[model samples]
Target chain A: MTTTTAHMSTNAATLSTPSDREIRVERIFNAPRERVWKAMNDPALIAQWWGRGNKLVVEKHEPVRGGHWRYVEHANGEQHGFEGRYAEVTPPERVVRTFEWDGMPGHVILETATLEDLGDGRTKLVSVSLFMTTADRDGMLHSGMEGGMNESYRALDKVLASMK
Target chain B: MVHYSTSLDSSFAALADPVRRDVLVRLARRDASISDLAGAFEMTLTGMKKHVQVLEDAGLVTTEKVGRVRWCRLGPRRLEKENEWIAKYQSMLEARYDRLGEFLERTRGEHP
Candidate 1:
């Protein structure tokens, strides 16, 4: 009932849980809606940003409805694979897709992203991910605490420590 | 199945009240007696006790009577875990978005 908003930093994305089974992330990008949409759907452009500067290989990408997409990110000598199928796609407006990580194959998240034009060459992206159940949502969130891609930072820390 | 949902429902119900949520936040900083909490929040002892009771029922707070004063503190079930997870998730997204923002800046004229 109480929405928990986590603001990472100034001028960054904000994440919240609006319902028991949903996680919402809202962010503003300094670009037109069309350009943002193109970057999101284009495989090369997605690789440029989706991996947080890590090398990302877009093995397959099809933004059309019912199309399948897969991406592999290489970080800290580990590969993280993510794949999904597009349920709906409306260019420069909205997209609905199913996202499943290879580490946790059976647990899939239905994600909906909407782009709103801010009219000043900026766009607001609202992404809401719906889990099958509250437990699934909690599990996915907690799983990030351990073996998720975020662990690469810890691995990097170890590597840096050895160098010193 | 029923037990899990019931406990989760109660936790949500307990957190629904702003006062109760504030109590948890204050307790997270340090434990305090019931009277201390009531005085800090500017509420009557009876009213603060009721809020603490709700939190206790939800397993979010625990109270113990030390002599005459009843001390309250966070229970075994801490909401900090959930908050930490959300914060980490937000940071990960923010990092990727930062890169996305940079890409947009570099390719602005090309895209237009």
Candidate 2:
């Protein structure tokens, strides 16, 4: 049997003292929610900005509950492959998915994205990933992801520019 | 070579908490008796015992009995196991990025 334990969570309420480990990132995109939503969904747009500047080949993608997603991140002749099932997917608003990298054991990362429309063309995307433990959270934070994420955003900016 | 994961599910389950993390952090500096460790926590001694048991189970700390004197010291292997697991993923990411750079270089040459 699989074991899953949840903390009191650093979300809306601080009810219990269940020790929590959390990571939250917020970004505002100049495009409208509908347009931003499309970029998140369209494979063409995703390919352009996914996984830093590496080539992302979405071999299979089905964004619905119980759907499976498998993609390969290829760069410099090496590949970082990851795949998982979608637990929940709400278009233009939310997506909950399980991520696992085949190369490493215990590399499971559950991710959640919440998008809010600011009534203007601008939209905000907040991503929170709940890792297995504090060590796991720190591993990602210290893994030099800051550069990759910034690069991904620059690519996204290019995508928005093309749409304009 | 120091990677060892003793299959004490309960012990690891207990170590998976922040309160317990605080206790382990304190214990690492020096060995202490039960009462001394419990005194540092807001929880009761009885409650602290449960946490101590978890640490013992995870093999992160050991409690010794010398004429009813229960002393605990940090068990270094448990920390090693966690770090080893993290290191594996890092190597994987680095390898992947190395390949991406080569691919980009080839594309530039061909287009030029």
Candidate 3:
């Protein structure tokens, strides 16, 4: 039985688990596919947004097949490093890569990001991450929560208060 | 982060086994006696007990003795914690995507 649940809802993004070992994040951006693709691939532009307003240092970014990329985001006096290797890089369409966090070594996630043109200058970016095992996927999910728990606690408090 | 890492490591270790994961999934549907679980998984009672023990240690499952049977169910913390983790993951990505949208707006006219 598939117990897929919508954990949270936002105006522009949706996250879902399509399978036991997969995570799919889909977002609609008010921009053309090419623009969205460039922002995702260009190191300078990636640094501006990938960190979620945190100080992002793009150590190495080569958005090409077989290229390596590393980015470090500084938040709350902590440095979080992420590195990956591009497996496929078809511009304005799809990019596949392996994402690994520095904190947890050897638990790499294979991510495939596809940009779809929705017309009228809109683009849909779908990113699916496939993990080696269900446990690895669960571990990654928990780590994400633990890492951002402090920063998001106030927002969660507001949510809880509104619910009550 | 260290504490989180340690706890997550144990959780991952506990869930690494397929049988244990299946046990959690089965328990999520309804509480079952240890014998019931062993029968469903077609494993020996002692083997199933070992898997349940690992899940219990990770706080993913809870077991109790009622008369002659040891009943197992999803732990008190399991579903809530899983939902919270998923929500946190979604919100984190949403925040980043919002920033990405802003960045796209700023560089709308730039050539790729």
| Residue-pair clashes per candidate | 0, 7, 0
TM for candidate 3 is 0.55
Best of the two (1, 3) by lDDT = 1
Give the DockQ (2 decimals) of all models.
0.19, 0.01, 0.20
Per-model TM-score versus the true fold: 0.56, 0.44, 0.55
lDDT per residue for candidate 2 within A1-164, as digits (tens), equals 00111221211111121224334545555556766666666776556555556678998799999999988888789997888889999988998987777665466767777779999866676766555655566777799777788999999999999999
TM-score of chain B of 1: 0.68
Among these predictions, the greatest TM-score belongs to 1
Q: Which is better, 1 or 2, measured by DockQ? A: 1
Q: Worst 10-residue stretch by lDDT in candidate 3 chain B?
A: B81-90
Q: What is the DockQ score, from 0 to 1, of model 3? A: 0.20
CAPRI verdict (incorrect, acceptable, medium, high) for model 1: incorrect
Residue-by-residue lDDT tens digits, candidate 1, A42-110: 897899888887899999988889999999989989998989999999987999999877765666678
Regions of candidate 3 where Cα sits further than 4 Å from its true position: A1-11, A135-164, B1-91, B106-112
lDDT of 3 by residue, A1-164 (tens): 11112322333466566865677888877788888888888887888889888899999888888999999999989999989999998887999998877865676678899999998888999988776545765687788866677769978999999999
* DockQ, model 2, C-alpha based: 0.01
